[model samples]
Target chain A: MNSEIRRLTTTERRQEHCDVLVIGGGTAGSMAALTAAQNGADVLLVDKAHVRHSGALAMGMDGVNNAVIPGKATPEEYVREITIANDGIVDQRTLMQTARRGFGMIQRLESYGVKFERDEHDEYAVRQVHRRGSYVLPMPEGRDVKKVLYRALRLAKVRSTNRVMVVRLLKDGNRAAGVVGFDSRSGNLVTISAKAVILATGAAGRLGLPASGYLYGTYENPTNSGDGHSLAYHAGAELTGLECFQINPLIKDYNGPACAYVAGPFGAYTVNSEGNRFVDCDYWSGQMMAEVAEEVASGRGPVYLRLSHLPSDTISTIEGILHTTERPTRGTFHANRGHDYRTRDVEMHISEIGFCSGHSSSGVWVNEKAATTVPGLYAAGDLACVPHNYMIGAFVYGELAALSAIEHGRSSSIVDPDESQVEAAIDAIYPPLSNPDGLPQPQVEYKLRRFVNDYVAPPKSATKMEIALEHFERTKTEIARLGARSPHELMRCAEVSVIRDCAEMATRASLFRTESRWGLYHQRSDFPDRDNARWFCHSILRKDSAGAMEMSTRPVAPYVVPVEGFEFPTTAAGDGEPDAA
Target chain B: MPSVLSRTEVPVSIDADLCVTGCRLCVDMCPLDSLAIDPETSKAYMYVDECWYCGPCAARCPVGAVSVNMPLLLR
Candidate 1:
């Protein structure tokens, strides 16, 4: 493979057929591609960036938690932890199955040569603890994890194409057979036909912020413009949990690039404008400074996170306790110690860093088998919402999704779509390429971002959401006028189309559920309180006749008792047992 | 490929008041050994060719004065 291949420049229509086509080469996508290939399926992994820098890769290798200790933890115990953390909104069956298979997944990761921290006793260290069932762990930075996973994908010989944007799913009746997308560099339409399609295309955070809307460069990896969610929805897959959105609170406030002094080494506390400590002081003890924004958001302060100095030994003690190998030196720490720089100085400064638990929680709803309502199409990772009370539940569910998809692919026969279905999807994009007077790509994206952020973001009230829906309805009319000058521009237009579809669905779901629950920030003043008896059901959104959004409710899967006790050690932290680090 | 532009233009400056007390924290943290105090200015100056834009020096400037701009786009 020549690394120096010149960037593609012309529109070349090419097609590749495979047994499994996995969109988005992030953590879950990498795992899915490898698993399918290992199971004797030809796999095609596509990503928006030239590199495999999806959300998971960018965030570093995450804390993989499982109950592996003898006598201290069980699958049931793990399930209880997730349910409690979710505040009764999690799907119990999916939670248990993910917990039960958590160890096997870690073993798979270890087989790929990804090294985890170990104790001085030469045993795998367990660093995670459960607080009221919310499993939390220390995540090493992003680069280390990406290197290990890239190696694993290479070892499996999975074929991948970078800078390819999947615009829509090619469907056969109700099942998904393939996807149609464009190569970003060369303005050409390309299609990948497959027997099964797994959407690992991560979250929709970028859809909310305008400046960083490009798939990899923006607030998110810019590439994650909710194409997978939109593709699945348009293919008639039932989308759930679109209402929950995560807001990352620990972002750097403007005060001249966050001094490594305040955030990195000094262990400074975040205070709001009025200078009050807002976050739960005792919780997040190790990263006590990290939760400053979240504490303020829940109405702890008039503004959000502000920094305060801590004792000199506080930083060193935390580093020593976490056994950090790379620690900041004293001289480096001293330079960043000034308080004169305030929030008004930087571009997109983060006054506080608070992330909505929703980003990890909401997604396409899947069953215990990791199968979406639409057959042959599966979702995993942050894209699929498998109810888990704890944060570490995502790693567990990612493994479960891989296993379920592998099983589904193996047992079921592959069905290729007829020519007409592919033609329909091709026709949707052909007009933009053919027409002389089409609206530019940037204009379409600007309109799409404004509509979603205004309607779908936190502080989502019924009136505001209704107004957002009206804006989306009007924007759909404007889509016909949008044009693309190049392949990349065409893909952006298609991406905005998908975002419009998702935003409309999210609005309908938000409107249907009147009461405030987990992730639905207290925007709706009237419908406050977690009404378990009345609003406990999962809000399922689907497209109805005439292609309008429709909403319905369904009961959450009940928790089942395990046949035998799987012994796992419980940490002093009390939520559940940690995985063999 | 031959370098697109033959010579790279480099920018340099010094703040004498930044080192009034003669502290050497900036020199100690420079991973590339690029900075040295000039006797004339009594302040740190980059050796130009040896500098790496790791940004540690700028981040560690005690009075929050040091600033460096490296134009290599990693992309």
Candidate 2:
């Protein structure tokens, strides 16, 4: 109940310099900052919240989704599976980097006190969640992930500024020079100059409104409102697979992961209202989601995770792991509704659409070295276009980005940011503050996201997407009228702008790839078919010099691992048999 | 135009008797920046209803006085 609103007349300005600048303190940014600092580089890590607990892994993850073990799976096998999973719209070299370097990254993470599930024989207890490979490794007690990363950062002597929301990147002749943002705790403008910059801000989770009509309730952390996507696009970086939205099967009203990945290894599977299994694979891919969506739309209107038949001990074990890990409030949420996994079926629903290259293939494009098209600028984790990167992929690519940044810092000199660009960033950020009596930030964001759900969510058509683009254009003016009562409100206002940018990107990308591909994701009502001859390659988009989003295509690079006449499977279900742990 | 003030129960609650006067563990760790120290009592309370209910506030509490419930809508 903060009723008082203050109109500030002037704001303080601060400046700093560093060898490497890491934008986010999430899974990838933390590793990037840690690795860069450990390699004897002066690093500055900035976050909108405290680095100790922020981003997607703020409460820690239940398991690593794409772990590649030496004996269990080889790099080439992993690459082929990901290529097929992403429907051959992948940069095989980038996936190979994570496939080859992930085990070492896992060992490095273990050195930093992160625990992994290993068997009595001291082998990684990897489970099969993919169609062809076994990669899902559970971290049953992995709740202190951020705390451990924060401690490692402290030991490395890396400088960090918490509660600062970065909104733009500073470029020195097509190379990333630094970043510009403002402190959320105090309304001071912050400008930091660096020789190399890495963008690790998490996915655009807040693009579509949740079914519960709640703004903060999103599958990804609500704090990650597509800031990195917007920042990279504004910096003139090429983004790929934006049409491949991140839509998962989550709990209905709670909007959390229904968590088949965790329960699947424990013998739980998704079934239709008739108590019959619909999809054979519980692995999260666009094809799996399409099958689930079809089942929900058919005679079997609602889907439920059938755990009622499992033994009592098995139920308790699944509950223990699910309750303590990511989205721990899930237990209380189910209890409040008088639903128990032992008796009643846990309800499942499709999640709101989002832009996550970690789960799908939509993000700022990066190479095997984790470098973006812009020099001195790098990206990794959920925001980078390494399809289905998951947590371990984020870790592996974070290390790669850090190694590249360290090498870049050794060769490059700090370039001075133009004062005019810094002033423009300041000018864009403070408009909401001056309009203290105008529209509230939350209302503006809610309406924009609602439009995303109406016009840009699945079953996309060119007509509806063009309408969405029109609404997003008008939303730009609506965002300008947002009012901020405090620095916290100002931060929310900035996120509204970022979310708007992501919505526009999603629409434009969906409209550009005039075909039904990636299953439920980017399924155009008009196109209705996947045209491999034309729309087979990666759909890339970026902000052109004219300040407009321009679309183009790049032929999928010569496949490092041969995939012969690959046509993405419309449905991955087979025999309806669940995989055992 | 006058700003309207409405009351709603927030997720994160701190017991004033058990909360340390100068401690800000919960306030500092909130990802959404929802919690703040009440100037009148020097006790931390959720100032906004925008809580993600991710439980960092409850986990980071030094005195074990903070508890986070699901936001009302989700609950």
Candidate 3:
């Protein structure tokens, strides 16, 4: 962790060069850097925080959500399940890449001393939590995931820097030429000129205001801030599936995941106040979210994950696993309220809306090679458009992006860094530092996110979204006035801009679809029906030449292995009775 | 614009005795940079209210110099 933090210059600013630059060193960026380095490209992996402990996988994950081990589950089955889970909005090629290469990634991580649960015969312990295939591979000791990746990065000789928060990409014509950002600790400016760039900056988790009213309280790591999503949009890269919001069933106020995946296989499940299951599956899909939201909104006002039914020993196991990985502080949050699994029910509420393809499909669009619409630019992990491609999928897509960049850079010459563009980027990052009495970032962000909640948080409406767009446009002006007394505050100010971009993208994409899909994720109250014949295409958004967001659609590529009888939870009870509309 | 320091106790705490003089392991690894080295004491301290309580500071502290409590608001 200490070794990952280094400074290149003593003065105010510095410049560096690399064949490939991987931004945001988390689960995916680490792999991208390693793959690029192993492929003989000089790579620079820069992160806003320490690479050893940053992004969604910073504290490490509890399990691999989509692991396709050879005998446990085949690639075909894995792809089909994800396609169905996402309601067929996915591009099969990239998802197939994740399914096929998932085992290799697991083996690679295992070689690095990262352990996954194994059966008595030494096979991967894959659990069934999704609608179809058995994919969840538990990692009880997975807190060491980042440590393993850090060691791998060092072994592969990937050059790196930390605490430098990249604000935007330096464009060479329409292609990404480099990156520019400021150090979050010292405010020292940074510029990295590269032949190609890979964005693993993670989800737009902070786009929606949490019910808790705390700005940092979000389902994803707070540092994500939609950096990749904003960067890609501004660089003119087309982003797809923005309408498919990532809404999870979380602990009411704390807002962390209720973690049905870890508890479901152990016999605990999500239930309304009546202590009856509403949805047939525990998979965190928009359909499941819709059902839960419906039940909670009705007379079954509150929800709880019923864990008291389990045996004492089984409860102990659940407690041990839930308390240690990912959101490790959940135990304390529970104990503070005197809620124990043995006697009391842990309260459940749906998570605030955000963009995350690792859970649902809303992110920067990319192909099977992990390349975005813009050449020399790539995306992976939750920010990439591979639906339901969780942790292992992040690693695979990272490898795909790195290899793609290496191949592309080896053939093409590095774009000459534009001096004016570099100056403009540096100029954009310093306004907060220059002001002494401007509006504080948190207030600005809080107001911005409140608009997101009112306008975009599910059960959507055309009139309300139009109103959301108006508020977002006004917030963009407020973001310019955002000031900071410290580098940390400046990071928030920069993040506000990113959040604004995501909010606009989400609203426009939601309105463009004109019909509800993915259940609560894109539930348009006005357009209350799924129009597969007309609205089946992926909703795409990007910044046009005139600097306005343009919304369009891209056809979902033909399924490689034909999909049939796929289902997302509908507006019906588990007993197949027609639920209240 | 003028600014006033708002007071709030951060959840993460660093044990001064266990921390080494030139070491900023916990400080560097904090995603929020909420943990910092006190220049005079040369020991890490929770300097800001931005901590997410993600626990990397405590987890990566080689000598186990850091510990985190749930934030005041959440608790």
Point out the higher-scoring one by DockQ: 2 or 3: 2
Over the stretch A84-132, how does candidate 1's per-residue lDDT look in tens digits? 5444555667777666766566566667665554557855555334543
Instruction: List the TM-score for candidate 3's chain B.
Output: 0.87
DockQ of model 3, rounded to 2 decimals: 0.67
List the candidate 1 regions with Cα displacement exceeding 4 Å.
A1-11, A59-74, A122-130, A139-142, A210-219, A252-270, A273-276, A281-358, A388-398, A410-416, A434-437, A519-522, A561-581, B1-75
Candidate ranking (DockQ, best to worst):
2, 3, 1
Model 2, B1-75: lDDT tens digits are: 466866777777889899999999999999999989999999999888887778889877988898777777777
Local lDDT at A158 for model 1: 89
- For residue A294, what is the lDDT in candidate 1? 44
**Cα RMSD to the true fold for all candidates:** 11.8, 5.7, 6.1
Error of 2 at A564 (Å): 3.3
Docking tier of model 1: it is: incorrect
Sliding window of 10 residues with minimal summed lDDT for model 3 chain A: A1-10
Please compute the TM-score of chain B alone for each predicted structure, in the order given.
0.65, 0.90, 0.87
lDDT of 2 by residue, A150-227 (tens): 899999988999999998899887888998898888877788999999999999999999888778888999998999
Q: How much RMSD separates candidate 1 from the native structure?
A: 11.8
Query: Which pairs clash (backbone N, Cα, C closer than 3 Å) in model 2?
Result: none
